[model samples]
Target: MENHLYDGLIRYIIKKTRLDKGLQQRDLADLHISDGTISNVERGKVVVRDDTFNYLLNKLGLDGGKLNELVKKEKEFIEHLKFRLDCIESMLNNGYLELANEELKLIHLDEFHPLAPFLMYLKGRYIYKKKE
Candidate 1:
């Protein structure tokens, strides 16, 4: 589910930051944290509570406020991209080839993007319509 995806993303970020700082899971220990909790969190075998997650972030010397802001912006950006893809699909379905092509031009999604296949489908529809 989307919640799992968010958890995965957050855990991955934490793991990456720890590694980038040349710290191992054991190095992130807190007085209240038991052995292996950090490792389990990094591996995502267990879900970390917000307080524990914030503690881990603090141990890494990361600014939790900034990280939260980045996550918020990323969510908003994804929503906007989804909206654009929907508009592109509607344009293609309505036989508005010129408008569809123009809208497609504005989207620069990565080749491996989750929506890439849908974008390709829309482009194919535009191409097929042109040959009609």
Candidate 2:
């Protein structure tokens, strides 16, 4: 993906990574970068230097290269995820298990979210319904 592809997702990924690592804002504070700056970056209010971005990722032991692509894909994934959830719920409610299962298969779970487990629940429900 191109650098322009970030489209503010860089902020989202970095911020989420920070949270997942159990590190607080102040924990990532450096001599030059403060917790407030980190907050701004995560909120998309500011863009830090490229080296700083890499350093932050390195601090969390995350690979920056692949992360960029993953974040890019996440943007698309989240959009579809929202709509798919509604469709899946409606299908399941209407006893259209097979159609719901097919729709679920089209979504890629490259990015992590609680929706993953919910999706699995839907799959199991589909199988259970088919068995009955």
Candidate 3:
């Protein structure tokens, strides 16, 4: 599960960076790898060796260390988001509807995000409380 999460996150980062830099997958190709492999990596459909992964990042001009730093920060932010959601849940359980709603307003996560279902569940709970 953890490995899948890492792969997905890496895929997002690579694709976003490549698009942002206006580079096509073929642009990353060299003698060591093909554009199809690059596409597979961006889609999280295949795992490559560490050297190959680093090579792809190098092609995007993103240093491996810098990518690691971005990953660390992303993980930290996700942890913080989970903590906030827990707090919102606790607020709802304790009948702090306004506070939970306020916290919900502060959060803006993509529906495809891993924790989005939890957020949706909380929203349902909040609505139930209102109906009561």
Please write out the lDDT profile of model 2 over residues 1-132, one tens digit for every residue: 222213555666776778878899999898967888677666656666766666666776767567867776887877778778878978988998878888978876524353567777777877888888
TM-score of 2: 0.53
Off by over 4 Å in 2: 1-6, 72-76, 85-132
Residue 131 error, candidate 2, Å: 36
lDDT top scorer: 3
Error of 3 at 16 (Å): 4.6
> lDDT tens string, model 1, 1-132?
122323644565566677779988877786856448787776678776767766777787766665666557656776888898888888877888899999888777645344567778888888988899
Worst 10 residues of 2 by lDDT: 1-10
Candidate 1 global CA lDDT score: 0.71
lDDT against true structure, model 2: 0.71
Candidate closest to the true structure, highest TM-score: 3
Q: What's every prediction's RMSD, in angstroms?
A: 6.9, 7.4, 4.4
Better candidate by TM-score, 1 or 2: 2
TM-score of each: 0.49, 0.53, 0.63
